[model samples]
Target: MVERVTATEETLQLLDKLKTIHGELMFHQSGGCCDGSSPMCYPRGEFRVGDSDIYLGDIGDTPFYMSKDQYEYWKHTQLIIDVVDGRGGMFSVEGPEGKRFLTRSRVFTEEERRELSIS
Candidate 1:
């Protein structure tokens, strides 16, 4: 099955480093203000996933989530998690590392959209 979310090799390596330091981690993307649009990394259970959030698969072993309303706008695309040189969200674990989690996306192909039942 096709994955709804994936990460680059660089990102995977960074995630490994983070996991060693922070233990289990998770990601959340929301539509609210204050870094909500950016993928925020937190130690698992540090961030709560509401019933309205959608699980978008994982990057390495880290589960990724999106707000239900945000998912509505992004469901037609595939999420590509990447790492960039910058300060991450203030509350994110990566903030002190000077590397941020970035979200890149591509519109799913017609075949993939059909397979995923995305209208």
Candidate 2:
């Protein structure tokens, strides 16, 4: 099956470091203004997932979610999580680490779209 979300090796390495320090982690992406458009990382169970949130799959053992409305606008693309040198969202766990999680994306191939349809 095609993954809706995946992370780069750099991102995975950072996540491992974060997990060692923060225990379990999770991610949420929203369509709200400012940092909300960026993915926010948090300690598991710290940020509640609402009924209207859509699970987009996991990256480095961390579950990724986005608001259903955001999903509607992003469904045709695959989310690629990467880490860049900078501060993350103010509320994200990685903010203090001087590295931020970045969301990159590409439109799914026709075959991938078909696979998703079949699923």
Candidate 3:
């Protein structure tokens, strides 16, 4: 009986993009500090998807559902939503468009490497 939670305009747009690429997405928080702390579209086991949850959308043309914990996390989010694309690429969200979910992970960005000077 689980249904997809309320999706904002921006969230829907992002979802559409993933659908086009036939990608899989996961949302998660590294449990860090800073506004919009959680990262979205995380590429790996960031959120831990399972087969027990009721999937609602298509990831890579495959529908997926969330675990109980995942649903809870989305229910209480305040800043952003974590997402992992079908291709296993991780990403985070921000701004008024995606400010409904609370972020938990440390902020992730392509710029992170530049800050850390990591290749």
Candidate 4:
């Protein structure tokens, strides 16, 4: 059986704010520069699942998942969020310590978060 993971305080707040403004939120972790770790959040239907996907289950009406590879790399780290509001953006968590290789990231801004009661 697949193990279930609960969202963290930062992540849960971000999800709630996203839901209020964007209807539903989805999560994805893919390889990229800067230690090859990146986390993303967009409207529920905005993400496309790749072939090697690991299902992370639903957050209310939001369906969340990650690539099997991403799950393996980040299952043990803290989660952060990055929120985008049109051209404005904010990070839910940041700094050198919170940022690193194989680290969990979810960039969301304080303004966007507070505007949505997420911060």
Candidate 5:
């Protein structure tokens, strides 16, 4: 099955470490106006998600969401959650760990699109 979101081994390790400290976590990526378009992580319910957000799938056992508008632009690609040595969004849980969560993407092929039921 095709996944809308996924995390690298490195990213999953970081998430597991964060989970030990923060418990369950959630992720949200809003329009560019929020955190310079970087994805932000918060305790499951710390950040309220409502009609404006769309669940993109889970990465590292964490739910991931994006503003409806943001999803429109990203729908054709797979969101690859990665980690790098740097500061993340000021409010993201990983920011303090001296590492950052980065987003990488790849456009889906026609076969993949069909499997994902994404036209």
Candidate 6:
């Protein structure tokens, strides 16, 4: 299957620890607020998602989403979620852990783009 979003090993480990404390989590990236470049993680049902958002698949079993406008610009690439030492966004769940979730990407290859009909 073509995965639109995936997480690094460090990210997965972080998510596991977070889940134990927060139950379930979800991620959203928007063009506004604190999500301009950072993927904000929230407890499930904590963040409201509407029609303006697009489901981008999951990372570490956590549902991921992006603003539709942001998706338009990012659809050509695959999202790779990683964790780094730093403070997270003010509203994100990872702030207390001293690690922030980061977004890294790779452009889709020709074959993958063709499979997704985006070539």
Top of the candidates by lDDT: 6
lDDT of 4 by residue, 6-81 (tens): 3545546556655676676666655543332445556666667878987766544455567776556555433433
Q: Residue 33's C-alpha lDDT in candidate 6?
A: 31
lDDT of 6 by residue, 1-119 (tens): 77888989999999999999999999998654322268999999999999999998988889999998888888888888899999979999999999999888888898889888884
What TM-score would you give candidate 2 relative to the actual structure? Answer: 0.92
Q: What is the lDDT of residue 46 in candidate 5?
A: 95
Model 5 lDDT tens row, 1-119: 89988988998999999999999999998655322246888989999999989998998889999988888788888888888898977889999999988888889899999998886
Each candidate's TM vs. the true structure? 0.93, 0.92, 0.33, 0.49, 0.92, 0.93
Q: Which ten residues in a row have the lowest lDDT in candidate 3?
A: 87-96
lDDT of 1 by residue, 5-97 (tens): 999999899999999999999999865323224699999988889899999998998999998888877888888888889896799998888
As a whole number from 0 to 100, the lDDT of residue 118 in candidate 5 is: 84
Q: Count the backbone clashes (under 3 Å) in each candidate.
A: 0, 0, 36, 13, 0, 0
lDDT (C-alpha, whole model) for all candidates: 0.86, 0.87, 0.40, 0.48, 0.86, 0.88
Give per-residue lDDT, candidate 2, residue 29: 87
Candidate 2, 1-119: lDDT as tens digits: 89999989999999999999999999998654332246899999999999999999999999999998878777888888888889867889998889999888888899999998723
lDDT for position 19 in model 3: 44
Where does model 4 exceed 4 Å of error? 1-4, 32-36, 59-61, 72-119
Q: How far is 22's C-alpha from truth in model 1 (Å)? A: 0.6
| Model 5 misplaced stretches (Cα beyond 4 Å) | 32-37
After best superposition, candidate 3 residue 69: deviation in angstroms?
A: 12
